[model samples]
Target: MTAVQGLEGKMMNKYGYGTDYYGYRKKFVVLVPSTNTAVESEYHLMKPTGVALATRACVIPSIKVTNEEEFVGLVKAIGDATEQGLKDALSCEPDHVIFGYSAETFWDGKERSDREFKRYNDIAQAVGGCNITFGAQAIQDALACYPGVKKIAVISPYMPVGDNMVIKFLEDIGYEVTAIKGHCSPGAVEIAHEPFGKTRELVQAVNSADCDLILQAGTNLHFAELAGSLEAELGKPVLAINTITFWHALRTNGIPDRIKGFGSLLSEH
Candidate 1:
């Protein structure tokens, strides 16, 4: 290796100086859509130690939409743009690549988010030859950590079609979705503009005794800010999808479970 490359190798080496370099605490990169905000928020909350993170934004000019046609077109465009963004983010040589946008690819009918995640992973792996995980996979792993959480309620800023896809994706993975409610977000930009207070209300509205856990879906919705508060008030686990996603991401990378102030999910898991 050249001088700079040798230095980089030493910096990234998990066991370079007789120190337990911590397995899984390597470089991570995220391909974020320009209009979305969840990935950065979740990354801050996790405060990954001994790991590096970088991001490349896809060509999402705005998340605002007035009609269905425009929204559909935006979603399709986001998926294509983000895939290309991931190809670029991989150039940083991340140990794992996170596709940090949701609802852009999650659709109803024959298509589903899981299929899209796998497809994205395939592309990322082919280009970068590294491990890959998406926000959905993290949510799935978080659900498994809470064995008693069989039924769940969701609050998101997604349209009905995108909402159905999330519900279906979770159900396909084996959880009983009890209640789900979301703002009629025509696109991701609108979701980003939603006030945090409104999201809290929606979260509490769907929370019920039947539901053991409450999920704040969508990476752009900024649910981690309320997870602990919601959990205290509702007396149940309020899992933000972004929070869970990062929690799982950290775990998959062998990072320790030490994040604080989010909820019992991240710290406890």
Candidate 2:
């Protein structure tokens, strides 16, 4: 054998990861902010047999975000907490990680998103050599599944600054964001508390006949269950960040189960 092969032969053991009878197919570590209330439950609701999720939360002292500056600060807080969250999650030796925060993923644009994903991925590799799935990349991938989709309408639980970031990111990735709106929830925790009626209204307000798909930002905003119904009514895709990210994680790891009722992104794609 070559020198590389000889060294690899004496390397660390592959611990039979994912041999857990429960997660024998694949194991996922889902990283979310402590302020998030939707990711874990939404992911659990969609998990297939033999797939397991271990959720690790990065605690942020403040969930309050009443303005643009505060929202930016919240993103910084999540960034600082995420590294340690990844380290703690590595204890379980998961096969992959799903980053369940949407704002950071959509902060700058596609290129920036790629760099951030790589930053977290490098951490995963150094510790245990696993991979990670990110929201912007996942949303981009989900949109790619529909080759004909280009015109997009977007809704979020952010103010103008955050929504603008998401819109610019979408455009950078080659989608035409025809219209966009934000629920502008007062605080991080309040993002999940935004009532269903307001979101559905925002969906209609942002959508147009020319729109090909509707996108939702903010993983903490509760929209997974509602996406399917919106699609049924609109005759187009409604891609929520959490659902798309979870779908991306499963598909990236080679889990091919067809999950139903969540929208075409899950059931059909």
Candidate 3:
């Protein structure tokens, strides 16, 4: 369903809006890369009432790699594959389309990320003939829910260089990104396999007193499980890309701002 319809539908479900004759169900379709198992599950859990969400997996054609050159190529290629996925998603006549993954858009820099996001939309418009949202763009929208949060601490499973790129992007956009902690995994594929238990440990390790909020950067990393609990433990906002992306997509479609038991940010927004 479109964000507006999604929100209205949810409100109607709880408060009863148009009860004339069982109004049409809202449908949201996501195009997720095969490697990204975390996003779909998170979206499903966070999905509001009356929103029927579906996923169409895109072939990776390869596993995640950390080698700089290969990483660059894979990221670009994923965008290409994702465009095709969007085309397929359009076949379902979804109200809106979501890229369903992060990092790929920010592979370059601030300008690069912006360009890539626009590029995705343009490509999707040309191929799928519909508008779509990227994870990075979703984060930007989600941040609006929490005003005056300038200092952010990033937790990631990327290598130091990859981490550096993300920090730079945030800094360019005005966030301090005061601290960062990454395993600098041997490779991107290794990051995909990084144990969720260990990821929780890293998040705990990097969280600091200076930051007002914590951000988990990669969509592929397992983060949904800790979102609610971590916010309660830290007493600070914690936003994972997966969570923020879905939140933004729903918001853009006009979904009401109430999604409880997910995170404090959702509660306050």
Candidate 4:
């Protein structure tokens, strides 16, 4: 083998990681919004053998976000609760962290996203050298797997303001957002209550002939399975935020599991 390939083979383990039994392959700490109810279960569904996941929710008030002001407050509340959430999650001594919230990562575009990732990394380093993976960066990495992808359609459980932020981040990274649809879910918890049919409706609304891919945001929204199913019917790739983030976490941590049924992002790429 080449020298680099030899080094990689030494690093990639054949058994569980760290000191856990269940998380024998890898131990992952996932942080989500306190009011969210979908992310943990979705992560479990996509979880591979010899992997373990512990979810910590960043506490936030379960209130309606009808306007931009309340939406901003919701964002602030998640921010206020995040540091403590990370500290609590670190007690498990996981190998990696998946920050389940997507808004902050896409808030001010790529520069701010990079800064926030570094900050989360610093916190993880303080405890035991674990690193963090965020949705915006993960989605970017997932998209890069398809070289011809240029225009994309987006769906999010966010307000118009929040969708604009997602658009800003995608555009900053040189992807053309062909269309976007935001659910404006009444509250944070309500995002989990969103029905599965909404995904098909949103996809139909935003997808165009020229669209190269369809990406769904909102970790709390249950769309992972739907993404895989839709790809078969749409004849293009559909990426769910949770799957992309978890996939990124798994691959970057030296877990080369080519899990199927979660779209080509996981199964093929």
Per-residue lDDT tens digits of candidate 2, residues 26-55? 789999999888999999999886677999
For candidate 2, the per-residue lDDT at 146 reads 94
TM-scores of the candidates in the order shown = 0.84, 0.92, 0.82, 0.92
What would the per-residue lDDT of candidate 3 be over residues 1-269, giving only the tens digit for each residue?
Answer: 55567556656677664432222444667788766666777787787666667788766765546566666565666777876677677776666678776767666667888887787778666765567777666777777667878999888867666688888788877788878888655543455667877877887777888888889887777676587788888998888877777776676777765777678656666
In terms of lDDT, the best-performing candidate is: 2
lDDT of 1 by residue, 1-269 (tens): 24455456667875666322332247777778888776786676676556666867887777566666666666777877877788888887777877676665446522456677788789777998886777676677788888887888888776666678778877777888898888877666667777877887787688777999988777777778689777877778888877776676677877775777888888788
- Candidate 2, run of 10 with poorest lDDT: 1-10
Model 1 regions lying over 4 Å from their true place: 1-24, 109-111
- What's each prediction's clash count? 2, 0, 8, 3
> Which is the better candidate, 1 or 3, if ranked by lDDT?
1
lDDT of each: 0.73, 0.88, 0.72, 0.87
Each model's Cα RMSD:
5.1, 6.9, 5.4, 5.3
Clash pairs, model 3 backbone:
1-27, 1-28, 3-253, 3-254, 4-253, 4-254, 7-255, 66-188
Error of 4 at 105 (Å): 0.9
Q: Model 3, clash count?
A: 8
Model 4, position 52, has a per-residue lDDT of 82
Q: Mind giving the per-residue lDDT tens digits that candidate 4 earns over 72-91? A: 78878887898889988898
TM-score of 2: 0.92
TM-score of 4: 0.92
